[model samples]
Target: MSADVNTGTREFILPDLGEGLTEAELISWKVEIGDEVHVDQMVVEVESAKSVVELPCPYAGQVVSLHANAGDTVSAGQALLTVAEAGVEMGAGDEGDGGTPASVSQSGSSTENSSGANLIGYGTSEPKTRSAKKRSFGGKHAAAPAVPTVIPDAPSQPPAETPASPSNSSTTANDRVSPVSSPLVRKLAKDHGISAKSLPGTGPGGVVTRADVMAAIESGAGAAAHVPAGTSPAKASSPAASSDQSDRDTRTPITGLRKVVSERLTKSRQEIPEATIWLDVDATELLATKKALEARTGEKYSLLSLVARFVVAGLKKYPIINSSIDTAAGEIVTHGDINLGLAAQTPRGLMVPVVHGAGELSLRQLRDSVSGTVGKAASGKFDPSELTGGTFTLNNYGVFGVDGSAPIINLPEVAMLGLGRIKDRPWVVDGELTVRKVMYLSFVFDHRACDGQEPSEFLTFVADCIENPISLLPEL
Candidate 1:
């Protein structure tokens, strides 16, 4: 049904989610057509490359229409929905039939009117303008002609159809804009050498989807057919192509967080010249200290929290490890505040949640921060901010029963400290061999950021602290 015809309608465009993200997959819409929505109320949920986020409505009004459906990928600055503010007069051109104003263009093009809607942390708004002459794929439902004014109590009659001509068809093809919701779908069509504008979309409002592009490929409308007749088709059957898919019974498309992780790790390896150093430390004292503390205070003190304290202390002495290399500027960037990122594994994938101002926190505070952040990450409730801005990373791969690993350096950060499993090992104490708790500490650092001297000393200092837990008492 139509909203109040007298009310002015404002289109809400999708705001840019941070970290240089250009688009997001629309997970679901919280509001429906004709539903009333309040300012700052969550109206939609979207899955970005990093995480899932709920977007709040910026204007208070009755929802006139939803521009994209669930599972559609939408770009930044695209119209998300229309809200007709209460008690505003609608212009003659803005009126719609059956009480619902046409919030979106029937041609499936983005709206052109600029609405200066602003959301906090996301910058200013811009209009997504469409061309004057609308184009469409061949469909049973044609676009309705624009009505300039409505006469009072006029009889509702269908507009007369105009006969199509050969010239009109040619012009339509030349001017045709694909009814695609996402840039990804368009890219798929282009990659397969298929014209999206020529394909009839089965999606709502006739929007082309990725599945449609795949269907075209399966129907022999792929890039191979578009090749010149004289060119050999050897490229398609090359050894490289077969090797790329060799022995893989099942293949999963890498998207979302996994894709982001792959890109970041790839960049890290390509850019950072890294080195790893490992040392086995006598952890008998550290384990005893934790047990003593727990018994004295009747509180649980995790070994990870204790080790994190040692890492913070070590960072204070070796600040260069907390720095990042800006290769483009040919400079080393050092951070004043230490944001400790703890790597935690969840069902979604590996995630590093950062604890801001970690160096300033006490042992108990660090424990609480680590516990809380890890809990949120495991439950998939952590914010994107928590996943970034890490000055250094603390990895406890020991939980997985590993002895040592050459951990890759987290990008923008120069180093990562890994703690391996603490187990009983024979140790020589006063010339007698005895069983003692031992653990391996693997320290990976960017050689460009600092020489071996600093990282070596840092690892030794941490090892000494673990061997003699009482040494940390002065700092505590």
Candidate 2:
């Protein structure tokens, strides 16, 4: 929605957080009503698809109204807050002649500074590239874009009655690229196999919002979306029906991150013919090696980072598992940059934080990266971009006191390596029964990409590295 003019207040629409992200859940408000706020002041914290981002307000004014409450899922371009500032007018800079917000411009200059925090897409727009660009996560999966200088924070759901769009931003179906700046809208379109270009957008400047895609999906556009077996498509819940059900049971509406995880896992299960294999390994040597390294260097290294070293080497030796399937292209895409992801349970939910280029990092650098990213994940403060572009994932269910698990593979990626709890278990050492520090490695792979042998070799290599840490030196 574009900025609305009241006598003195100016609306601050949710600025685009680049990587195709369309909506975010409001976590908390940093400022209260009537509080004085400066330009670039952190106004609120929002949780995008995978990260918690603090949105900075661009206008310096007295805080007026918060359109949505905490935990509200705000769509991109929706009105978030209104500011009443002196000398602030509904100028051309605030919106285009057609009344659409300027945030839709996908420029290369993103974030406050080029060397600032790991933010989303570029911000500065060139006159030639001022056209509304299709928003996408950099890879198969992406985070939200940055808030541009012209636009500040945005969003709450629009009113039940749809607002009329400006006449210039018409939705005529010609040979035009649909102005889809929201990743959520694109995702909904792709999930239903509905090409957005076929439908007319109701958003400002003809940008496709999630609602338009949903309407097209409901209208039976293109291929029918796959509904989970034994489950029918969900319908809009009636208030009366929901009220009656609430008396009998506590039914929480599934939305936001939980909804995303559910959909992603369902897709993974439906599309992937994944097979799991597990083996117990003697990790006594690996423990000793970690302790020895710490004692000599007087530096701390986590088991995860140390194990990551082995996983990195194993991936190099067998790169087939470090890949994703391009369903549209019918191609198996192997990644040159090994972005390592770790699956962990955070307060928000199960999130896989990614380290962009894990393959090139040394053991110490890997430890630092893993530690920093994992810590941020635990606290639920990691940047959204850090959650995308992962080639492989490592799950340490061991910390949960579990021996083994057949975990679901993160989508796009073909494989996931699971580490079980290590304990003193009796093992055969040199043909003799002896107590050793043992752990289980559970490997899951998409059978579509490779047969059982490739993953078996990769798993065996990882297990060997754990059983004999020194054996990894050759690969080093």
For model 1, give the 10-residue run with minimal summed lDDT. 132-141
lDDT of 1 by residue, 1-476 (tens): 01122234555667768788877778899988778887678999988776788888766677765667676666676667767775544444432321224444433322222225546433334233433322121221234233212112224854235533446443343233446655566676776567775666555345667677778766766555555557788755443343344324344546667778899999999988999999999999888889999999898888888888999998988899888888889999988989999988877788888999999998889999987886786566578888888999999999999999999899889999999999999999889999999999999999999889999999999999999988877765
Spell out the clash pairs found in candidate 1. Answer: 2-99, 2-100, 6-90
Which lDDT value does model 1 have at 120? Answer: 42
lDDT of 2 by residue, 1-476 (tens): 22223323444566676667777877898987667777677888888776777887765666555555565567766656656565444453332212322243232232221223222332322112233321221121221222111111223634223322436434335334444544455655665556675567555344466677767755555343433346555643343454355347543546667878998999999999999999999999999999999999999999999999999998998999999999989999988889999997888788888987899999999999999987876676667777789999999999989999998999999999999999999999899999999999999999988999999999999999998999999999
Best model number under lDDT: 1
Per-model TM against the reference: 0.73, 0.67
Task: State the displacement of the C-alpha of residue 61, model 2, in Å, after optimal TM-score superposition.
Answer: 3.0
Off by over 4 Å in 1: 1-7, 85-178, 183-199, 210-253
